[model samples]
Target chain A: MRLLTALGQDIRFQFRHGFYYAYLVLTILYILSLRLLPESLVYPALIIILFTDICALGFFFIGAIVLLERGQNLTQSLFVTPLRLHEYLLAKILSFLLLSIVSAFLIMLGGSVGGQDLLWFIFGAIFSALIYTLFGLVFAARARHVNDYFVKSLGIGLLISLPILAYLGLFDTPLFYIFPTRATLILLDTLGGDYALSEKLYSVANLLIWFTILSAWVYQRFDRYVRHPV
Target chain B: MIRVTKLHFAYGSNSKDTLNGLNFHIDSGEVFGFLGPSGAGKSTTQKILIGILNNYRGTVFVNGLDLQKLTSDFYESIGVAFETPNLYTKFTALENLDFFAQFYAGETRNPNELLEAVGLKDAANTRVSDFSKGMKVRLNFCRSLLNNPKLIFLDEPTAGLDPVNLRKMETLILAEKARGNTICITTHDMHVADTLCDRVAFIVDGEVSLIDSPRQLKLQHGERFVDVEYRDGDSLKTKSIPMDKLGSNDTFQDILKNHYMETIHSREASLEDVFVKTTGRSLQ
Candidate 1:
């Protein structure tokens, strides 16, 4: 019940702060960009867009949100309430995930893509958003300002995006599978259909493993840098 | 409702301890003030008690619960107003209060009533970004009471208020005290400490030098005399007479009979004077 209430406030806060409006504009642009592409190119383009941008919205947004709250010293007021740290983190993660899911759904619909595997698409969106958002929070916890967060996150973001080289066929190496984005790309590829069940299972298991690892790292960093800052 | 013994805290392994062997206890419904200058461990103690900064070598019990073992439910019974206004700038006064009110398990105060009590009813719909510093401080105070908490922690609650608003804040604090709520105030504002606190602990260099009522402190440190200002012929003159034998003092009687008395006042030390004398450091 407390988590739901916190989530409600977080969503309202995001809405009032223009997160919804920003996504509305961005999603429409993504759809328009995809519409201009040739029919043969639409599926691959859509997957690339979803993997690189839509699913990663939380990664960029959560940093701004957390840093803004920190700058205002709102965390001190917030943590003093009955809300636990995990609840607070889940509320943030879920709120941003809602935005990412809605944007991905609209983009796919407007792109005239049909026969897509809706279940896998959503699973990919959820896992990708969850991992990236948690990843962003780790940096956000240690950053003193939004600019600092972005500067630090950019380096980490580029390192994770190395998997894109293999996806684009520019560099194909088995080591690319070590990055969580490889699992995200594989799951998101299911939207194009014809993906084997074994690969889907591998991606699901891989993402879950990555999620568990990131969750632990996020919890420790947030507890140290945010909850008990010196 | 709060007790501390041998409380010691340091920011880092190499740094000096910020709080050193502090000992104090506040009774239920008592208004306890931690009076000290900036960097004197006043806020550090409050944070430790409120479960914000937990690394300390001491035992602190708030409502019989250990500080180190506190759970989320521990916050249900307490409210804290930070020294700075730490509110959402985009949120309306009402929205901010309503948002926080949902976090508690039990009954909470109505947002509108809390705003009205703090003279913020007219601006309830206004975003906090538009509020003046004093208004934000008032709204922050209102947020602290939303839980109807049994114990309240107010840090420099009246730092940015006009005289009228400051008095209103003081009156509201006193009213809360009357309602059997224990309040711990951390501030260097001596007037506030003198006006609201039942007992104040004078802290300096991480050590508490004195703990007593403001009235008692003044009496103990002040001279037993009264200063009289009188107009004599062409100029105003002043005289000091011992308060013990004023009625029997011939000079005081002669001044009242022969000259037009302008003003008379008892010579009592202010809280600031007592703080300086006791702590050997000014509040500035």
Candidate 2:
């Protein structure tokens, strides 16, 4: 109850005029990009196209929001409230999860990507958002200042992207499956419901593991690390 | 009431303890002042008391409940106004109050009434970004009362305000004191400590050098003499005389009966001078 009440205000604040505009502009831009994508993705290079475009963009946006909060000192304010540490970690995942799902689904729908595959795309985008949002929180918490945050985040992003981007030339078979980008491929190919038992098991297990590790770090270290100097 | 015994807390594995063997108790309804220069364990002590900083080696009891034993319920009994105004700039002052007030299990006072007390009622509808530093400080003052707390923690509560607003803040603090609220104020400002604290602890270099009531501490260290000023043949002259010898001193009698007295004032130490005397460090 304490956590919900504290987070409610922050969630609502994010939906206010200035914040809402930013969210809207990002959503519109994403949808427009989908509309303008090469039709080749709808057929042949679907997995490559999905991993590179929507999933990547959504993760980048999540990082941007976390970095903004760090810059504005909202994270510090949230730290001082009578909230348990895990509550914030959970709230961020849940809030961003819901928002990105709605965002990804709308863009896929408006761009004429239809049927059950669209639902899977939304689910994939949500998983990717959760993973990267946690990643961004860890980085933002570790950063000493806002400018340092951006420079370091961009560096981290480039390093994480290296192998993923190399998939275009380095592999004859689908390489996205080794990464959580597998979810994005499944969604774009509309293969979520069609995937085998072992594949489903792998996706679920990896998601759970990442979430557990990130949440534990949040509980143990995030509070002390981000407490502003008095 | 708050009690801390042998409290020890450090930032990291390689750092020394910020709070080491700290022992103190604040009785119910007492206004306690923590006076220290920058980084002198003032904030560390306040954070420990407010449940913000944890993992410390200590036995801390507040309102008869152990600090570690209690959970979110501990926050319900106390209010805090940090030195920096951490308000939602996008929201109106009233909206900010309304949002935070919902988190408390305790009955909250009306936001408007508290804002009116601090002279921000007319500005309630205005966005917090539009408020000046003093206005924001007033808003923070209103925030501390919204929960109707039994204990209040105010850090540098009057640091940036002008003299007029500073007096208003002092009066508002007195009003809280009148209502039997135990307040723990942290500041490097000596005047705020002298005028408001019932008892103040002079913290210098992570240690408490002296702790006593402002008046009592002033009297204990003040000179036992009075400086008498009078105009003698168009020249202003002054004489320092021991207060005990005034009953038999002819010069004192002559001054009282003969020449017009320019000024008569008791020579007593300010709390700042007392702090310097005890700690050998300025309150800055």
Candidate 3:
């Protein structure tokens, strides 16, 4: 219940800070691109847009919000509350993921992607959101300002997007499966009925394992951030 | 309600200690004040007690539990109001309060009532970004009391407030004391320390120089006399009479009986004066 309250507050804060509106605008843009672009280019555009915007955008989005909270010294108040770091992190991830989901769903819905693929798309979007949000926190903890935050986040963002190599045909080996973004790409590809069931299961399992590891890292990073905040 | 022993803290690996070997204890229901000049470790000490800074080498027992061992539950019983206003600027005053009030599973005060108490009733619906510094301070104070905490840590609680709001805040703090809540106030404002704190500790250079009740300190260091001002014809005359024998002193008696008295005031030292005398540093 407390988590829900915190989530509600976070969502409200995000909306008031223009994150919600930003997502709405992104959704409209995605819809327009799908409608205006050639059919053959639409799928690739959808993959790139969904992957980059939904999964990767959270790193910078959450970074911006964290920096704002730090500037206002709201984190000091939050640190003193009964709300633990995990609960706080969960609230942030869930809130930002809600925006990611909205954008992903609107794009996929407009693209006429449905059935099991849509469900996989939703799952992939959520996992990607969670991963990048946590990834953002690691850099946000060390960043002193928004400009520095974007710089650091951009570097980390590229590291997380290393899985894009598999999609671009630069690397096709199974070693790419280690990257969470690779899992997301595979999920999207499978959703489009281009991959076998066994491969889809492998991608889901790999993503889950990465999520578990990132979750632990995020928890510790958040703890350190709270204890000795920059 | 709070005890610290050999408290030592430094900001980084090679930095000097910000708080060095500090030791003090605050009794339950007591309004204890941590007084110091800027960079004197008053805020660092408060932050430790409030569980915001834990990288210190010390055993801090708040409400009978060691701070190092405390979980998030420790915050359920404590309230903290920072010197600067830390609030959601985009939210309305009431929304900010209500949102923070949800953090605790325990009972919380009504948001509207808390705002009204702080004289922010009219601005309940107004976004905090539009509030003045004084209004934001009051709203921050209101947020601290939301959980009805047993222990409250106020860092310069009355800073940026007008005289009227200062008085209101003092009343609210005293009321909290009356309700048996222990409060620890950190401030360089001598007037606030003298007015609200039952006992105050003077800190200098990350160490405690003196700790005593304000009244006791004043009486101990102040002159044991009363300054009597009276009108002699059209001119004013003043005499300092020893308080020990004022009732029997013939000169004092004669002056009281034969002179038109203007004012008689006890020669008591202000907290600021005692602070300077004790710590050799002003509370600037």
Candidate 4:
């Protein structure tokens, strides 16, 4: 019940602060861009677009939200309440997930993309957004300002995107599986077409494992750097 | 309602402790103030009591619960107004209060009533970003009371208020105290400490030097004399008379009978004076 209340407030906060409106414009642009692509290129382009923009929107947006809250000293007021750290984090992730899922669904619909496994697409969207959101939180905790967050996140962003090279078959390696984005790309590829059952299981297992690891790490960093900074 | 013994804290491993062996207790329904300058461990101590920073090497008990063992429910009974106005600028004043009111499991005060009490009723629908510093301070104060908390922690509660608003905040604080709430205020404003606190602790160098009622502190530190300013034939003159025998003193009687007395004042030390004398440091 407490989590739901916090989530409601978070959603209201985002709505009032223009986050939903900004995403509305961005999502429409993505749908239009997808429609302009050739029918043969639409599926791959949509996958790439979803993986880069919608799934990763949480990464950039959560950083901005956290940093803005920090700058305004809102965290001090927030953590003082009965709301636990995990609930706060979950609300943030879920709120951003709402935006990501809505945008991804609209883009897919507008592009007339179909014949994909809906469950895999949902899982792909959720897990990918969760991973990136948690990753963003880790950096946001350490960032002193919005500019600092972006500069540091840009470096982390490039490192995480190295899996794209492996996805494009330019630098394929088993080592790429270590990055959560690798699992995200594999899961998102299911949206374009069916894959081997073993590959799907591997992708699911990889994302689940990464989610567990990142959850613990994100909790620790947020507790240390954001909640109880020395 | 609150107790601390040998409370010690430091920001980092290599740094010296910011709070050093502080001991104090606030009875329920008492208004306690932590009076100190910046970096004097006043805020550090309040943070510890409020469960914000818990890595302290001492024992703290609030409302009979150990600070370390406290859970989220502990917050339900406590409200804190931070030194800075840490509110959402994007939300309207009423919206901010309503948003925070949802966090409490128990009953909460009406947001409109709180806004009205803080003189923000007319601006309830205004976004906080449009609020001046004083207005934000008032709104921040209103949020702290939404839970109708039993124990309240106010940090520099009068930092940005004009005279009129400052008096309003003070009256509201006294009203809360009248309702039997224990309020712990941390501030360097001696006037506020004097006016609001039942007892204040003069904290300097991370240690409390004195803890007593403002009236008692003044009596103990102030000179036992009264100053009289009288107008002579051509000029004004002043005389200091010991307060102990003022009625029997011939000079005081003569001044009142022979000269037009302009003004008379008891030489009672202000809280600022007592703070300086006790802590050996200015509030600045």
* C-alpha lDDT of all candidate models, in order: 0.90, 0.73, 0.86, 0.89
DockQ of all candidate complexes: 0.80, 0.31, 0.70, 0.76
lDDT of 3 by residue, A1-230 (tens): 77998899999988888887887887888888788998887777788887888666678787778888888889888888898887888898888888887777787788765555466666777787778887887877767888998988888688878878778777676677778888888787656657777877887888889888888887787777754452
Candidate 1 structure quality by residue, lDDT tens digits, A94-161: 99899888998899889878554678767877999999998899899888878899999989988898
Task: Report the Cα lDDT for candidate 4.
Answer: 0.89
Q: List the residue pairs that clash in candidate 3.
A: none
The residue-by-residue lDDT of candidate 2 on B112-217, one tens digit each, is 8888888888999999989999999889878777778999999899978988989999999999999999999999988899899999988766667788999999
lDDT of 1 at B35: 93
Residue range B81-182, candidate 1, lDDT tens digits: 999999989889999998999999999999999899999999999999999999999999999999999999999999989999999999999999999999
Steric clash pairs (candidate 4): none
**Could you give the DockQ of candidate 1?**
0.80
**Candidate 4: tens digits of C-alpha lDDT, residues A131-169:** 888889989887887788888887998798789887777
> How much TM-score does chain B earn in each model?
0.98, 0.96, 0.97, 0.98
Compared with the true structure, the alpha-carbon lDDT of candidate 3 equals: 0.86
Over 4 Å off, model 2 = A1-4, A16-19, A29-77, A117-122, A154-178, A191-193, A227-230, B13-17, B68-70, B245-249
Q: Could you say which candidate leads in DockQ?
A: 1
Residue pairs in collision within model 1: none
